[model samples]
Target chain A: MDRQRFDYLLEAYGADFARWPDGEREAAAAFAAAHAAELTEVLQAARALDAALGTRRVEAPTPDLLSARILAAHKRQRGAGLDWRAAAALAACAVFGVALGYGGGLLAPVADDGDYFASAFETPFADYDGDEG
Target chain B: MIDPDADLVRSAGAGDAQAASALVRRHLPRMVALGRRMLNDAAEAEDVAQEVFLRVWREAPRWKPGAAKFETWMHRVALNLCYDRLRRRREKSDPDAGLYVADGAASAGDAWLARQRVAKVGAALAQLPERQRSAIELVHFQELTNIAAAETLEISVEALESLLARGRRALKAALADVAQDLIGDADGVPRV
Candidate 1:
């Protein structure tokens, strides 16, 4: 990295090499070390700004209530999805049951009430006569 | 690119409470931090974080990881929410919109000074243009890789660097005094 490029990156990313672009970090570090005597002033300025920016601390303490609320929302959505799926499954089962009953009825032999009564009468008197004998 | 959060996101998407909770635990703080930096309001920051997660849950089941990582997408959503809120603040033109309110409880000398310094730095950050502020926040505070941060902003890495440079320059100028104080404090000089 040339002086111009190094200074540009330094100003942009501050003194922390970790913050520098991945492709240029090693080259920039080498340049800095090689010209430490000359780059001290610029590097110090960048570090100073970094430290100043660091003072603006943000404490991100996640409130339990917020977490619970988010999780609850997720559960609620999932629950609704499950409810829909369950309803669909029940409907499908009902439809299948109806179809099976209809299909079985169609496939079964039809019984004649007339034939049943005739056969019953045909056997009724014979059994009675035999008992009497 | 292999996303580290892919497994978690998939499990969470499939209604795994443990996975969802883990996702929340891992990303909630960073989301909150980004919002806090952008909006400079704790309550609103929490709102942004919650909103981001809400979107996450909504999209999780259908979330197809494509170009961006899940974390990067979350950051983009959070940033857009922040930008929307910022735009609304501008439309309403609230005088106290970006003001950094120091804690009234910090009465101790050192604590008060530190709070003052924080307030100053925050105000300076607040003054930056939205893109510039976002660039600095992502690179400096969020510590996102350049590629990730650039994707979050929907900008090229070169443009991201430009924004960072401009943002840092403005901040450097604005926070010069605070920088001096910090440097002084670091050098063993007593903070007055």
Candidate 2:
């Protein structure tokens, strides 16, 4: 690896060679062996960083309350308002909507309001006038 | 290679109680750690971890393993939860601002000094922009591989590295005095 690429990896992954990307590990090691002086500087900086940052121990104990709460939430979801029957009913409605959208025209075309009006009006003014007379 | 959690996830999805419990136990600590670092509150972190597992339990049956590692997905969920809480905090103008600072009043000796450094680091971390803090948290603290961390943040590996570099620089700048105290002697040499 070149100096620039090696520096980038050093900044990104710190001095721990194992943390470097697997593909670049061999090249990185080779470069480190060749450039011991620069590697030493980087390692020193990374070690200081590790020391400073690692001081605070972050512990995440599995509290019984948290575990119980999580399990209870899961169980509640499983048994809650949206059971299989409700899911099936929702699915059936969706299927009905899709079927209507695709095949409704084949069963019956919607009549035109203008055509119905025109046919009724054309039924003869004469008949209407005679009846009025 | 198949992820070790693939089978557990499948069983969990199939409503297997033991498998679900195993998955929770396996992933909760890291998820909580991630949330704590991101949110800076242990109680809230625990809540976020619970929500993440709740989501896992609901979505497990439909989990497609080959697309990504289950742990990566879990990290994503926890990150999302943390982000949500952060947004809410911002909306409220940080009513709980003091929650981020750990109690450091009662310590003595090296323990006190070490705590000061940790508190400074944590404070500096909290001061960074959200994405940079997340990048540092995922890589430095969560110990996710760069590729996995990138996937968790939904960014490229290159972008993730860029964020890390910037975050590290900012951290070094913010913790300059603390770093000096911890490692720098009067002559810039390390203390024995």
Model 2 DockQ class: incorrect
Clashing residue pairs in candidate 2, if any?
A: B13-B61
Clashing pairs in 1: none
> Reference contacts recovered by each candidate, as fractions?
0.71, 0.37
Residue B60, candidate 2: alpha-carbon lDDT:
83
Which stretches of candidate 2 lie above 4 Å from their native place? A79-133, B90-107, B184-192
Q: Pick the candidate with the highest TM-score.
A: 1
Over B13-83, each residue of candidate 1 has an lDDT whose tens digit, in order, gives 89999999999999998888788778877788889999999899889998887778998999999999999
B29-125 in candidate 2: lDDT tens per residue? 7887777767767788888988898889888878998888988888888888888898888422332222332445645665555555666777777
lDDT by candidate, in order shown = 0.87, 0.76
